[model samples]
Target: MSLLKEKILQVASDLFQTRGINSTGVDTIVAVAGTTKMTLYKHFHSKEGLIIEVLNEHYRHFHAWLSERLDRKKPAERLQKLFDFIEEWVSSPDFHGMAFLKASAEFPDASSPIHELSNTHSQQFRRYLAELAADAGIADAEGLALQLSLLIEGAMQAEQIKRGSGAIVYAKKAANILIKSSLR
Candidate 1:
């Protein structure tokens, strides 16, 4: 990406994540990006287009971060590492709940591109969890993945709404019990 485009994306992503997709306008993005509407349109056809790009960028960043943390760990260890990462993530000052969830909330129509993109991001995460479960020799890998994914999503919402880190800690404990039972 060009410098201008990169700046636009950065500013837009930050604003969208902090403020909201519907709440943040093109003018504000351009102003923050230090660019013009023309430049933004040149890079992204419209605000929806820019939002799709932002969602993709967010997924890329998240996948990279997750891969780095879980790559070297054993399959069994990866499950625990995931919760550890989530704890750190929810506890961070920059944490502002799941961007994908926010986008889904803003665009509730399943046919909407923004909503689909958000769903895609979520499904990808669930698939990753499934892969990890399979690698760990779990018999019902997909089932376990679904369960874990629910726990993760719930914990994220709880942390954001409750403004505390206890959700993740409880989630981790629940996950441990689930894993142990599944292994036997």
Candidate 2:
């Protein structure tokens, strides 16, 4: 990303995450980015366009972070690392539910670019989960991975609603149980 685009993404991601996609205006992003209106419009056709890009950036960064931590780990550790990662994310000061979830909820229709990008990121997560589960030798790995993915998503939402990270404990426990059962 260019310096300007990076700045714009940072400012817009913060604003959109904190304020919301529909509530946040392009001017707010441009002003925060310290750039001109033309520059903003030049890069993104409109606020919706920018919002989609911001969501994509979030997914890209998130996947990068996960890959960095997970790609080098042994199979068992990688599975646990997945749990740990979500736990930490839920407890982070910046926790604001799942960004993709929130964005898709704001615009349920799949036609919106933001909604589409959110779905794409979500599918990527599932694919990663499947790979991890298979690598761990879990029985019916693909199906089990989907279940685990849904469980993690649920845990995140529960933690967000409860305003604490404790809900992740259940997810961890559930994953352990699933692994054991699959082995049997």
Candidate 3:
């Protein structure tokens, strides 16, 4: 990405995550990016296009972060690391709610490209969780994955709505119990 495009993407991603997709305006993004509407359109074509790019960026960065945290750990230790990753994530000062979750809510139309991108990211996340569960020798890997995904999502929401409420801590305990019972 060019410097201008990178700046626009960073500003838009931050604004969208902090404010919201629907509430944020192209003008504001351009202003923050220190660019013009023409430049934004030159890069992204339209706001929806920009939104999709932002979602893609989030997906890439998140997967990279997750891979770093989980890839080196032993299979049995992966779940523990997963919980630790999420706890630290939710506590970070830059912590914002899940971008996919926010996008899906803001663009509820099932047929919309924005919604599709968000849903795809979510399904990919669930699949990644199932992979982790399988690696851990869980008896019902898919079931365990679903349980863990929901727990993580709920914990994130709790942190967004009730910061410092120990939601992630509770989530980790519940996750351990679920993992223990699911072990083959």
Stretches of model 3 off by over 4 angstroms after superposition = none
Per residue, candidate 1 scores C-alpha lDDT tens digits across 1-184 of: 7999999999999999788888999999999989899999999988999999988998898788878889989876787688898788778887778888888999999999999998999999999999989888889989999999999999988887878758999999999999889999
User: What does candidate 3's lDDT look like per residue over 61-80, in tens digits?
Assistant: 88888888888899877976
* Between candidates 2 and 3, the lDDT winner: 3
Tens-digit lDDT track for model 2 on 13-115? 9987778778988888888889988998888898788887888788787778777888889986677678888787678888777789889889999897777
- Ten contiguous residues minimizing lDDT sum, candidate 1: 156-165
| lDDT score for candidate 1 against the true structure | 0.89
Clashing pairs in 3: none
Clashing pairs in 1: none
Candidate 2 or 1, higher TM-score = 1
TM-score of 2: 0.92
Model 3 lowest lDDT segment of ten: 156-165
The clash count for each model shown is 0, 0, 0
